[model samples]
Target: MAEQQTDFDVLIVGAGLSGIGMAAHLTEKCPGRSYAILERRGNLGGTWDLFRYPGVRSDSDMHTLGFDFEPWRHEKSIADAPAILDYLHRIVADRDIGPNIRFGHKVISADFDMANARWDIVAETEDGERKRLSASWLYLGSGYYDYDEPYDPGFATERFEGQIVHPQFWPEDLDHAGKKVVVIGSGATAVTVVPAMAARAAKVTMLQRTPTWMFARPAKDSIANFLRRMLPEQTAYRITRWKNMKLQSLAFKRARTKPQKMGEALHKRIEKVLGENFDAEAFTPPYDPWDQRLCLVPDNDLFEAINEGRAEIVTARIEAFEKDGVLLSNGRFLPADIIVTATGLKLCVAGKIAVSVDGEPVDFAQRFYYKGCMFSNLPNLAVVFGYLNASWTLRADLNSDYVCRVLNHMARTGADMAVPVLPHGHGLEEDDIFDFSSGYIQRSKHLMPKNATRYPWRLNQEYLVDRKRMASEPITDGILEFSRARQDQGAAPEMAAAE
Candidate 1:
């Protein structure tokens, strides 16, 4: 193999929210440092750019999703996909960050060179050409969603006759109007698809293996709009962001502390709005609220669609797909002209790229998560993963800030590499990280971090705790070690223990 060459101080994969955030932070904090961001798709905005399904909107409030330095000026609190993509584009163009981003480049593998104390990254282009680049630091922000493929059931390809489509890979040419549609799965995507398709399609049926707890909220806030006009953008943004944070935190606390009472109150609210004829069991989730993400239905649109007779909910396991539609395990066959498999996504850690250290592949499955960023044995490589309970950007922002601190610390101390070293006999066990039985999460259990009932590994969704740990706390929490390289040889372990 011929050696291809490129170099950078920092190499970031995926130009989505986290990738862009990482680039912005690095450029601002470490000026004159050569860095590049690689994006697989032709455009940016990872999830927003990929999913083009009808009525696509964020599950979280826009205030929290928006960048801290950049205020989201949308009229709606829960923004549509296009709006979010536009915001990202504006940020990229305004900051002149586009130059640093190399679109249509997909990273295949990354190997850490122990002797040189650098990472060699191999990326393939859309046309099948491959190139290799070296960088001192490598950051993975590829996100969780799989871009090219859908998670269809094994029997789907041969059995289903109707046009089957996944929300993530929705074809632009396929038309859903005037047809009977059946959307599989019960989550944010399924809830969003049913109502939107119902408007144009003859009828839309949402097939769920299990019921999800649905909550109704306005897409736009009158108070937020008022404040935007009355107060400065920064002030309004901060106020709304913090206010939503507090409300969400309070809700989570109430749900956990007084689960029975909170569940009853929520059940009553759903019954009152959905009416006497509504099947309460279909709308109520079996598990406690927040155990899985609470499904947000904008303006009661899904329920309204159901009430209007354009949409219906079927809470049953899909036994298999038939020639015309899906067959339920109970022997009922629902006919559909089109099938939308909103059946969740595949969680790909670090975009499923092979990560190696010193020419040896590192087993992330055996590693413990340090501050949810650094892996136990991986050196000079940090991953940005967000909170499962709060807005993803909240945790990602903290990770970016901390990475900057790490970079500054490295440069100031003349260190070539810094990797988190877990104490001896420390290993994550199964049944501790994710307790959910959801197929997407359960299948990827080995690639994810286990949340112990302790600190760090146990993910605390509270922003205050994350803020104190990432920004205020010392880096030398006894888990990470930094080493410097001399002119004659490679990185030598210098013990300036993190205080």
Candidate 2:
């Protein structure tokens, strides 16, 4: 049993949204392969399990966010945390994925031994047990944010008498009822929490150093429900997903071309709904559209909260935390019983797990990402990075499918190891992967991978573009180096056996 414990054809690193979707794909597409998903937490949901703050919800539409094979039956395009978690749980139960998941296994390192053509994975269990697992392939499905350590604003929490809270670790027992709440940051998370907390709180204020782009979209998709009644469940979902995907793609392109126009349009839309009471001066941002992600408020809920006198938006910088509340740089002090720091997430590369190829440490900062999924020079490893302009699961599905395609190609060719080699950098300069100017991205740009100026080297952020390329792109484009099994174990299973 001990010897058998370490063996698997593939090892998945997280049981989050991407991990679960990948597992389902592998089960359907590669039935012969043995795989296991190791989640560091006791619960299956990664981000959903970690963040329990009020008004926690998905900014992207659920039609595109849901798994390709599974159709989301819900009406709301923007779903709350509990509904999203329930969807994940339902997928697991329906697929019988519970048996394949090993909860509480925090992976420490994965070292690839070239001679054996296998990876030795070291993981520590929650109860302090160390286990070694061996596999031919590794998949990183853990989302980018670090659960153990959230981004700290470096504010003086000690001086403040009010309850200072970070959205990542929301205290369940904290009494926030009827208190004056001041939330810092203008990102999606802050916008979401403001309206939800404002429903009960006496007053909620959103304080941001710089205002982010905010737009209001309908919470429910009436067209989707209408199509669902007329068409089959799977058919309706696919059609709606594609429709949303294309619209999102078009919007990004137009925003890039006509930033000023797009920005003005968004501002006008918000102002029209907000009426005479709206603060157009505060809502207008300095940067152009799509420079950073836009904050989405469902059904003008945030605007309604502001107009109804339950919430207010303040654009200002924080000087320091006073005894009672935050002192602004503009010589204004906002008194609050509760101060919520919804600043942003701390970006992490591949979940911050240590990885080494042979004996040399893998420096992600110096590496080039191949096809936006695997790092150049890495063998049998794939990472799922979602699009910033659209739903994350769209990219996850395509990445998983690409992995299956590569694995099947190797099986057909009787090759056991495949590595992507960068072509001497082609004298092409390295550029940043993400084009956004968000604070979290700017803070962690040094630790992330770079993209090249060439195709398959430069990552595509467009969903439709990636869909076509990832599906039809040649797997062996003279870049990936494939090898047979090490001589000691056996010759790569005979070509005839693969058939």
Candidate 3:
């Protein structure tokens, strides 16, 4: 029998927002490079599909959250999960890229065949049968969500709980109506679940050790809608996207440089709704804004719930869980019929895939990120990581175009491998992947990718700066070492003709 060959020029992992957007980019920017997407799940839309919890929606504005190429024509700037899923489906259908995606193919590992300049991918089908595929480049579109198992804090143990639920594994039939509910954690999940359940529940309480800053934004973008009606589709989208981008950038910088100023403004906004009872010390986070992501309550739903006395906030440490409810460290008890542990997501890097380079196990943390996409010493591989500060798709769009540019540059040079190499004594300070204080990131501890001090190596979370570096920047900066193909036999018969 003839040897099995690598099937595509690029093999994309995970079929979510990132994966779909990547496919669209490759289709438009590098039409000649054939690619295949391997999705472990039987369906598309990663987070929008998996997260079935109540009020699942984007915290960021749709103007920035939506793709650069696609226009978000919806009235609601903050979209629900189903709507987002529908949007993704429409894009896939419109671009005619659905056929290229193979569902139920879970990529477990990738062994780089450097001699032949291809990757031998090991994946298992939905039926648990092992299979292999290969590609010239592997783009990891698998997001950082911990799908297999959510993070259990190991501290909230109780013997006589009615029901303890994690939003990740929310039961469809678990009705919360008329029942007293207690949501644990101070992050976006808790904020969302509280009000959603409050609408039907007897009473809801948000229990947090430390409070997170919450702001209210309009659910619908009236200005964006007006502009869309007045101007062309792309033009309207460009204007709205940039407007949000600049505003977000400015706010983030102000939060960093002037925490007190931002904090005061936040307190004032909430006080206008809650009046005098709103506790500044209780609601105000110890860490500054952008240290942990600020939570957005669209149309002030969370505040409305609080104002209506349907939901209440309790800022205290949990001594432990009791039979009926939770016991506070400061000698207090909160009753609950249902407990929702919206603690946080467990960060997963590179989809937790065991990747090797030329038969050697890749130590990812030791390596620095090359422009937040490619890793140092890693060849022809780009991992899709988004902005820690801004909307994820913003950075994702940049990454997609940059990846195509690198591929095109390689084709022009007749190069098969493009690896990042740092010079000796580059004198770059290594930094953490994110400076956020969320429990998930803190628990991850050193497992995340590193950042260098200097240009090209240090990934900028700023979109304005990225526009110059990721778009107009030259590829041949003496960092990316390019070379010709090692061999020609690995490519599939269909891809054998590609440059």
Candidate 4:
């Protein structure tokens, strides 16, 4: 069969926030260069569109979550999913981004055409037809999460008699009104589900395998709201955005640097809210705070739901699922008409795309990360990783700006490729990057990036430091090497290998 082929200057996989951001920057910085964003879903806003479970809101403030050029006009600092989706849609339309987006095209594999200095991307359409495309550059902004897989236990779906659902794959028609609902997992998804489910479900029980350090914060600040009304929207947004950004950054820094003090303060605040019903032992996380993602409750709504008897918290190991519900390790069975597995998402590094340079596969396990952007030996590609501590967009935006600078520098210098090349003996070790044993990061440790020392590998989550390093630094940093494409002409290989 003949393969259908299309050509572009750049081919972007996943039309999510990052991909859209990339498109916006590319169009603005390097015009007349063709680029196309291929999305698996029929719409934009990746996770926002994919996840429909109730109480979906940005855990981070919307001001920081939104693109810097675009101001988030929502009344609430922490806006819900629908509003976010709308914001992304508006950006897509207003920026003329839709023309560059091809919906229902899922990237199956991307292979580097060594001889041609290009990428051969293979994708499957919604209709099950396969197509091939080539691009000078391939940008993978797919985000980490796997779209199809649910992280429930081995026997989760088979053993559970009740309707089992994963929030990532939530069914719009699934009924929960007046039915007893059991939400599994203790991350952001579970925190959001419990409160939303409690409103309509007869009772919502949060079943956790382990405890998460959760804190209550208002979604809408009274002072910010008053200022928004009194001051201009843009001015108010700038002030609130910077104010929240600094405050959150400081809080996270304190939590990481002086954990005991900050943890104690957070614990005390949580205890005050829970009052006599608080189970300190059950609620306190085993690891230090921020080791795992912290759970955020907007305006203490989750606690309110629990105190109102609409929700209940259960901390126990699930031995198995019974005919009607979940059986705990202690042999106690909790009846439930519906079960929502808010288990974490599977992280797909570089959208599981195989990366290679000159017929050699780039072994990410051995390669060290340079400034948390480019990896050693992989030319012309940089992965944008966000802050583990604050809003993801804050770091992503900086990375995007840095990418533009690098690309602009390359164009001006006549360099065809740029890759991070750390000094010999400077490689990251596994232990330095992550110490936790939970979620996808733990499961995919071997595949993820790590830091060996304080510089590039250390992953300094501080915005001030990152801002100086990423934004203000020269594009031609010594660590990052730029080179022109090889002039050697050769035929294409029979089969491209995976990384």
Clashes of 2: 0
Q: Tens digits of per-residue lDDT for model 2 on 337-400?
A: 9999998899898888898877667887876778888877778899987888888999899989
Structural similarity to truth (TM-score) of each candidate: 0.93, 0.95, 0.95, 0.91
Candidate 1 C-alpha lDDT tens digits along 62-175: 898887878889999888999999899988888778888888889999998766778999999999999889899999889876676667566555676779888887899988
* C-alpha lDDT (0 to 100) for residue 260 of candidate 2: 85
Ranked by TM-score, top first: 2, 3, 1, 4
- TM-score winner between candidates 2 and 4: 2
lDDT preference between candidates 2 and 4, better one:
2
Q: Write the per-residue lDDT of candidate 3 for residues 1-499, one digit (tens) a residue.
A: 1224338899999889889999999999999988889999988999889888899999899889899999998889999998899899999999888988888989999988777888999998889988898998999999986789898888646564689889998999999999999999989889888999999999999999899988888899988999999999999999999899999999999999999999889888888888866878768888887788889988889888998999999999988788898889999999888999998888878898899876787877767788888887778899877787888898879888888989999889888888887655557787666677888888885777778667678667788898777777788878788875556544421111001
- Which candidate number has the best TM-score? 2
Q: Tally clashing residue pairs in candidate 4.
A: 1
Arrange candidates, best lDDT first.
2, 3, 1, 4
Query: What residue pairs are clashing in model 1?
Result: 433-451, 476-498
Comparing 1 with 2 on TM-score, the higher-scoring candidate is 2
Where is the poorest 10-residue window by lDDT in model 1? Answer: 490-499
Candidate 3 Cα errors over 4 Å, as ranges: 1-6, 423-426, 487-499
- Model 3 lDDT-worst window of ten: 490-499
TM-score of 3: 0.95
lDDT of 4 by residue, 1-499 (tens): 1223388877878787788888888877777668899999998998788888888888888888888767787778778989999899888888788888888998887766555667777789999998888887777788876787856456555766679888887888988999999998888899999999899999999998888888788887766787788898788777877888888878876777887887788788877887887787767877888777678888888888888999989999988887789889988788999988887878767777666655566566766666777666566666666776778778667766777778778778876666666555443454456544467677777777656556765455677688777766787768677665555423422221112
Error of 1 at 221 (Å): 2.1
